[model samples]
Target: MGQRIFRRVSLGIMMCVLATGLVFAGSPLPNPPHKGEGILTVNIQGVFNAKVSLSPFKGLKTVEPIATVADVRGNKSAKIKIPAQYFPGEFLLRLDYRAKEADAPYPAERIIYINQQNIEITVNPPYINNDEKTKFNSGEKENTVFSAFMKENNAKRMPLDLLRQFLLSYDQPKSKLYTEGVKEFEQRRVEYNTWLANQAKIHSKLYVSRLFQFQYIPAIIWSGDAKERVNQILKNYFEGINFSDPLIIRSRELSRFMDGYMGLYGMQATTVALRDSLFTQAGSVACEKASKGDPQVYGWMVDYFYTGYESYDIKPGITMLQKHINNPDCFTSKKQQITQRLESMARLVPGALAPDFTMNDNIGKSFKFYQWKPQARNKLILFWTTTCSDCLKLVGELSEWYKQPANKKKLDIVAINLDEPEVKIGKWKAVIANLSSWKHLHAEEGVNSPIAREYAILSMPVMFLIGSKNNVIVSTPGTIEQLVKDLK
Candidate 1:
């Protein structure tokens, strides 16, 4: 009986010790053990009828909400369940609330990083960044570490950036002051990069470390003309990037980085033709670099360039995308869209037969896009919408141009309106009343309609000039002036 009593007491002691260890492991301290199933709890005050939304970054500046909680009154708390996929990445929280009883809701957003831990934050929507007004859980590590790093990083980077700028623009390169400035700038840059590298190593296990990689600035040669200096920057652009890590795609920094790189090319372009050539060359070089690193990143680079090229109607750049298109290893999410763009490039060239399609006009009369019969000297097929400001601008310009008797006799236009969401249809109807000179048709499915897919109409204000004799495309004119020139 004494032995049995000892065993029972020992088992109870073991259980108690285990519980204590678990509590201590998750205690309120820096770098506490990660616990919970990726839950975000928001406690907001100073507002009513509050709606909180949690979103994950899919691309630079593009976020889609994963969870939402609505009708949270002032001084109340609400929980948002973050799915497993979104964890281990950065997130954005948006609060929509009303300060007064009748006032319209105001929106405010805060950025936070989540790494499989329960985060509870108290915020006043209007003053979310004020330390006194808002607070996060003391035990949270991901955001805390990131915030501290950025604070120091900005402080370190300011002087270096300013010094470098001064050195680049300083007229007297041989002056003692300029030489001293260059030396100082180089010393500081080396120190900053060293600190950045150390910080990344210290936080190697944290996701925020991946972000630190972008802060690694490459060395630039201050001695040279503008183009030569830009070339030096391009040569070392990927010095600090770890392209093999797919997480770079989840950060907006990547987009900004690419934008800066592309802007370098833009600076050297003096004409439209030169700009197109430089942009395509930039795309080729950048995409090839990424292709050697990660397949997803390679696909992202290809998609980015393709989007830009399509928007600018850069046929050579569009053609350059063909090399990256057929690679099986590329995991670009925009595969279908890319394929459609390539199809448009191949089939929409001059002298090529236009795809034929029969659709009812707004008046229920059937219209054929292409046929053997002749109606006029040339036909213009315009894809547009009332919602798009650019499309509206183009249509307004074209309408005024078409008012001339000679233009009306030479060109017949078929305007395909891609307005939708039912309300836009009402607006389209109202707008087209004054635009009756041109035959109008509405595609109910917007850009996803079969006709749009055939033409690969990804964006607005696309036009095709076709000869009425055999429905062969004469040219894809970007502007009204170009259309007039093509007709001549």
Candidate 2:
């Protein structure tokens, strides 16, 4: 009876080994069963003294794992059978087990992919130098594990695998990991862009035949900054190419994509430039073709152009938007918004009558631009501050001019200190102390003074000369020297 039992166990072990080898060999080929087709099977082997379980896949309900255990030569192995209907993408294969001895643990985890082609991944637990409890909590160790998994699996999968790893890394909640992943993704994007550019250049005509090239351009544009590097890349690729070129003609799709991308980011200049360039190249044919079927593209162009006009006073940009926004509803809404914003900007246009505003001087005396009368040939309301280097430089030049005999009687320089806090105004006072002939006033009310905002003061060292009628004679002259020249 012992002989009979021994023979039976030997036969079972042989059968299991044969089944495991066959399954492993067939896995990588594209022959996994689909619905109403052959059922896909997974047989796990080489596990010793551990419990194993398979989780139910959430995506495909019809797919289930069949669990079985067998004892061979005092060691145990687990087998799982997976059904068809699971998608071709990556799926997690989880294992759970505890070792009977404290020193010995299950040596490996396996990854299984089921589709027309079956893929298996074998993972070994990394060696931990410190205590097991500490190892579990080590972020560095966890990163190592993840990196190993990506490196091992990356060979089997192509670009998609790298993309998947990037997505996984980005999903990590920790900022450090997410930042690292983003950096890697950016590097990959740069490499891909370079590769695509090379391919297009080599097989210029052949590449344009594929419609996908159009889709690729917008992504390349989005990943990089609109700096010199990107500009050079685009110029090199598109220079000397006319609208008749197949790639140039096909680039209309890319232009549409850019319109949507820029609109989402609210980049007024880039959106307007791209749409205008496309319109010039494709003319009415492009618009009419897009209107007939690609409403999304048309709508993106329309919205981008309309918003561009509202954000800037570029006349050409406004004209482009006017041509595209012919639809009554869109035109009306966009027209109203643009008109309102334009009117607001028009009030700040240079060479116009400077707005009247009141501000308190350092001595608590209120001074109004329209009301103050200077005691020189011309009153120059030279807007400046102590903190501005350019303003200081201009003041040094003006001081030289004051020392000259010709300009002393002709120009009156009234300094307006826009700096805050009475203490911070010392720098301006100290600089002006030597030249007591010129008048200086500090706007004690800080930046909130109505005068500052009315003049649209953004930077320092601005100058506005008020004529006898209190009208602004010169607004934002090129430089101090230029202002003096203009006065002469």
Candidate no. 2 TM-score: 0.35
| Candidate 2 segments exceeding 4 Å error | 1-137, 140-345, 348-352, 357-360, 363-368, 421-423, 469-472
lDDT: worst 10-residue window of model 2: 18-27
Q: Please give, for residues 1-488, the per-residue lDDT of candidate 1 as tens digits.
A: 00110011221121111100000011112222244346899998887757999988755654778878977888899899876666577788899988876989899988888875788999989998776777889888778889889899989887876776677667899899998997887788779878887887777767677777667656657677656766776666665576666666776767666766776677667888998898888888888878887798888888777767766777898788777877886777667777788778887899898999999999998887765344578888999988777788888999999889878888888899888877888889888898888889899899999899888898878999888888889999988888888888
Tens digit per residue, CA lDDT, model 2, 7-111: 112211211111000000011222223453322222222333444433333212213444433222113333454454333322334443333334344433333
RMSD vs true structure, all candidates: 14.3, 24.0
lDDT, candidate 2, residue 296? Answer: 42
Model 1 TM-score is: 0.88
* Count of clashing residue pairs in every prediction: 0, 3
* Pairs that clash in candidate 2: 30-116, 31-116, 32-116
Question: lDDT of each structure?
Answer: 0.76, 0.43
